[model samples]
Target: MSVSTPSSRPSASSSASPSVADLVAATPADRNRVVDLLRGAAILVVCLGHWLMAGVHVDGAGELRRTGLLGIATWTHPLTWVLQVMPVFFLVGGYANAISWRGARARGTTYGGWLRARLRRLTIPLLPLMLFWAAVAPLASALGVDGGTLRIASMASLVPTWFLAVYLLVVALTPLTLALWERCGWWSVLGGAAVAGLVDLVSVGGDLLAVGFCNYLFVWGTVHQLGYAWRDGALPGAAHRLGLAAVGLVGLLLLVGVGPYGVSMVGVGGHGVDNSYPARVTLLFLGLLQAGVVTALEPALARFAARPRVWAATVLVNARIMTVYLWHLTALGIVVGLSLALGGVGLHLQPGTGTWWATRPLWFAVLAATTALLVTLLGRLEQPAPDPRPAPPAVLPVAALLATCAGLAVMADLGIADADGTVNAWLPWVPLVAAVALGTVRLPAVRRRGDRSAPGGYLAP
Candidate 1:
C-alpha cells in the first residue's frame, strides 16, 4: 500500500547511508508527503493492533493456547472502528497509481514494461519468506511441537500474504481501472459501491458465502476509485469532505445498528458475521468516512509533514514499509515461541487484566526489538539489483502475475503447514517458481549488426 516514489530506493552503499537532512533536501518539490505519512502510519497501526489483540497463555495441561482479545472482551468491538485502517492504505494506493500510471504513459512506457517494473518490486521480497517457512515447518514438526500450536503460529506469521495477494491484483488492473476513471469519473465509484451492496445483500439473504468474495474488488476498488477522485480534485472543499463523512456515518449506523452486520470491523473467529474476510458494504462506508475525515485534515497534515525532521522519518519508514509489514507478525511468533519455551514466564498473566495491561510496555519492547532485528537482516532483499534482462512477450508477465497471486492465495488459506505440522507440498515451490518466472522472463535474442547475438532488447519503452 505504500506507493513510494522512485527515490525511495535505499542508498547504493550501506556504509555511506544518507543522513536525514540529506534525504529531506533531495525530496522533489512536488512530492506529496501526506500520502507517504498516511501509508507509514497505517502499516504501523496494523502491526501494533495485531500485537495488542493477540492473546496467548499456557493451558492447564501446560500447552500453549492462542486466542484473540476481541473475541474474549466484547466491549472492545467498537475500537476496530479506529484500528481498521486498511481503507486508508487502499485509498493511498489509488492516488499513487493514478500518478504513477499517468507519468509512465507520458514517458511512452508500454503496459508490459510498466507492469514488470512494479511486479519485480512487489514479488521479489517474497521468495526469502517462503523459503524461511518451508524450513521452519519441518524442523518444528521434528522437534515435537504439537499440530495445533504449529498451525496457529504458521498462519499468524503468514497472514500478511493475504493482503499482498489482493493488492497485487488491484495493482495489475490499474491501467484498465484508471482508463475507466478517466471516462466514467464519479459514476465509476458509485457503480462499484452499488455492486458491492448487491453482493452483500445476496450473500446475506441467500446464505451464499462464496458470492461475498466479489466485494474484494467492488469495495476496495471503489475506494481506490475514490482515490482517483482525490487526485483529480473532485472532492475539493471542506463541505464536500464533511458531507462524505456524514453519509458514511449514517450508512454505518444503519448497517450495524438497524441491519445484520456485526459492529466489529475486523474479522474475529466465531463471531458469526464478519465485516471483513470477503469484505462487506460496511467497510466501504468506513472507508468513505475515513477518506472524508483524512482529506478534510490534509491541509494541516501536509503542513506538519513539511517539517524536515518529520518528512525524513516518514521517507525512511516508507522505504522499508513492505518489509516491516511482512515480518512484524513473524517477530510476534518468535517471541511467543520463546515464551512457551521458558514455560510461559512472562505470558502467564490473564489477558484484559490489570497485571497484563501493566506489562504491555515490556511486551511491545521485546516484540519491536525482535522485529527490528529481522528487518535488519532481510530488508536488503526489498531492493534487488536492476533486472538487466529484456522484457519478455506480453503474455509472460500476465501469466507470471496470475501464478504469483494463485500461490499467495493458497498460502493464505492453508498456511505453510497443516495442524499436524506437515508442510504443504506447495509451500516454497509455487511462489518460488512464480518469482523466478516474473524476474527472469526475457525477449528472444536478436542478431546485432556485427552478426553477434544481442542479449538485451526491451519489449517496449
Candidate 2:
C-alpha cells in the first residue's frame, strides 16, 4: 500500500536521470533492501498468479467466456497458499507507514499534512484508471458487448481498485493503530486478531452475513500491525519467527481442516465460504504464516537484495509498483480481448489441456509485453507532483478521505458498468470524489513575474 520512490544520485548534468548503478549506490545504508525486494516480488507474484488462474476461451458459440482455473481444478485450491500474497503486501505497508509516520512527526508535519500526503500518493494514481473505465464501459456496451462479457472485463480490470479501497481504509486509520501499537506493543496485534475471530464467529455462527465485512479491517489491520513489530525489531531471532509460523499453521489447519472455512485463500466460484471475499480468520492465519516464513528468510533475502544488479532491479520495480499493479490485469484483459477478436487463436485450447499448459510461456510473454507498454505510458501518473502549499484545514482531508474510500468501495463492488454494460449509477461520482481528494490540499497556482504562461493551474497533490 506504500508507494516508494528510489533515491537517485545527482547526475553531472541535472537534466539526465540517474543510471541504475547510481540508484544502487545512492541507497541509504539503513534502508532495508529486503523489504523493497519482497514488495516487488509480491506484486509480481500477484500478477502472475492472476494471469495463470484466468481461464479464457472463445466458446463453441463464438462468444468469449472466462472462468477461474481454481474453480475448474479444485486441486489448485492449496496452491493459493503460496499465491495469495496480500499478507506480505499489508505487512510491508505497515512497516513503511510506521517509518513514514514517525519521520513526518519528527519533521513537524501535522497529522493533516501527513494524512494529505499519504492520501494523495494513494489516490492520484487511481484517476486515470477510473477515467479509462468510465469512458469504456458505455461505449463497449453500445458496440454489442454482452453484459456477461463486460462484467467479466470490468471485474478483472478493477481488481486492484478493490484492494485499494481496503488498503486506503487501513492507511487512513494508521495514526490510531500505530498509536495503539506504541502503547500496547504485541497486544495491539492480538486484539485485532481476536476481533477478527469474533467477527468470523458472529457472522458464520449467527449467520449474519453483513457483519462479516468488519473483518476487512480487523484481519488486514492485524497483519499490518505485524509490520510495525517487524519495523521495531520486536520479532527477532529464529525462535520468534518459527513460533509464529507454527501457530499460524496450526490455526489455518484448525480453521480450514476442522472448521467450516474453505481451503482456498483466493475466491473460487462455487466453492463454499470463500476465505478471501470477506477475508475470514483463515486469511489472518495465512498472513501470520507467510510473514513468519518470509521474515525468517530475511537474512538470506537481504544478502540477495544487496547485490548491485538485484537491488537496482528492485528499485526500478518499486518505483512504479502502483502503476504496475493497477494496470497488469487490464493488460491481461486486453490480451484476452485480442485473442477473442482473432478467432480465439491461442485461447481456443481448453483449460487444463496439454496444449493449454504448453502455451503458458507464449501467453505469459504476451502479457508481460502488454503490461510493460501500459506501464511506460501511464506510470508517470503515479508519481506525486511537487506541492509546496500548506496543508488545508484538517476537515478537508478528513472529508476527502471518507469520500474517496466510499467511492472506491462502491466501484469495487458494483464496478463502473452494470450487467448490461451501461455505466453504473455510481460511476459519475467516482471522478468527482477523486477530484475532491486530489484537490483537498492543493493550492491555486501562482505565476512568477514576467511569466507569460497561464496564471493558474491545477496539480495533483
Candidate 3:
C-alpha cells in the first residue's frame, strides 16, 4: 500500500556476500523481538478465528440456535483472510530456521545434528500433550459422548498437527536450500517458483500431490530467505520492503481474482480444498504478502520491542506459543463440551438471518473467558527447556516407550490388527509423530565432542 522507497539501503546479496554465520550472529535482539511479535500475532489471529467461529449460546429458554453464520462458517469455511496468519507463522519460521542453522554452522555443528536439535526443541514437549489426548480419546468416545463432536475435535487437531511435520521437513532441508540461495540468490527462489507454477498447471489436469510439496520448500523457503535479507540489511530501505508488499498484494489479487483459489485463506470444508494444501499457489502469494508486511513494519516493530516490558511480555508469549498452539482446539473443545454437558446450550447457536453474526460479540466473550482458563491451566507444557547435560543412553527405553504409546493410540483408533495381519484403517499418527519428532529434538546436547557450545544454542547475536 505504501509505495515510496526510502534511501540508504544496504547491498543486495548479489552485490555482496556474507558468511551465513555472520548473518546469523548479526541478527539483533530487536530483530528477534519483531519476529516474536509477529509470532505472537499469528497465534492471536488463529485464536480469534477460532473464537469467532466457536460458541455456546443459549436462548431465553436455553436452546441451540440451529442456523447461524457461526455454524455455517465453522463447519464449512473459516475466517480465511484473517485466519491466514498461518503463512506468517511459517514465513517467520523460515527466518528462525535460517538464523538457527547459520548459528549452528558457525558453532561447527553438523547439519544433521543441528537440524535434529532444532526438531527436538520444536517438538519434545508435545509428547505429554499427545499422550494425554490419546489416553482421553477412547474415554470420551466410550462415554457415549457425541461421536460427531469427537470427530470434529479430532479433525481440528489435525490441521495444526500437519504443520509440525511439514515444518520439520522444511527445517531439515534448509541447509541445502539456503546454500542455493547463497549461490544463485534470487534466481534460486525464482527457480522454485517456476517449479511450483508448473506443477500447479499440471494439477489442473492430473493429481498434483508430489508437485505440490515443491511449495512447502519453495514458497516457505523464499520467505525464510527474507530473514537473511533482513539480517544483511538488504531490505534496509522502506521502499524495498514496501515493494515486497506491493508484489504480495498483486499476487493475492491475481490468485483470488483469476485463479481457482478461494478468498478465504484458511481451508473451507464443504466447499472443498484443504486450502492449506500446497497445490494452491494462492498460499505462496499470501506468504509473499505476509513477508512483505513483516519486513516493512520491522523498524516500527523494533522500536516497539525496545521497551523492556514489551519484550518481556513477548518473551512470555513466545514461551507459551507451542503450548497455546497445540492446546487451542482443546480449549475450544472444552468450552463446547462443558457448555453442552451443562445443558445450557445445544452445540449450535440460534441461526437466524445472519443472526449469529450479531451474536458474535457474545460468542467472543465466552471464547476469551474459556481460552484464558485453558491457557492458565495447560500452557505449562510449552515452557520446557532442553536439558543442558548429556543424558544417559536411553535409546532402547525411549524407543520402547514411544512404540508402546504409538501402538496403543493407533490400535485404539483402529481395532487390533486383522486376522490377515492387516491394519484396516489408517490411524492418525500426528500425536505420536508430534511426540517422537519433538522428543528427538529435545535430546541432551551431544556436542560433536570436538566443539562446545551452549545447550539449545543458536548463533551468537
lDDT of each: 0.78, 0.78, 0.56
Across 1-461, the per-residue lDDT of candidate 1 in tens digits comes to 22334464334453233433445555667777788889988998999888888887776788777768898888889899889998998998898888878878887877777788777677767777888887887788788878788888888888888888888888878999999999999889888889999999999889999999888888988888878888888899989988898888899999999898889999886664789977999999999999999999989999999987788788667656777888899899999889888887887777888888899889889988998888788765554445555656657677778887887777777777776567674665777787665553222243223211111111001
| TM-score per candidate | 0.90, 0.91, 0.74
What TM-score, to 2 decimals, does candidate 3 have? 0.74
**Reference-based lDDT, residue 350, model 2:** 74
Clashing residue pairs for model 1: none
Please give, for residues 345-453, the per-residue lDDT of candidate 3 as tens digits: 5345454337656766776677667756766776544423334433323342244234434543344333323333332223434545534454453344543331221
| Number of colliding residue pairs in each model | 0, 0, 11
Model 1 ranges with Cα > 4 A deviation: 1-22, 270-272, 440-461
What's the residue-level lDDT of 191 in candidate 1? 87
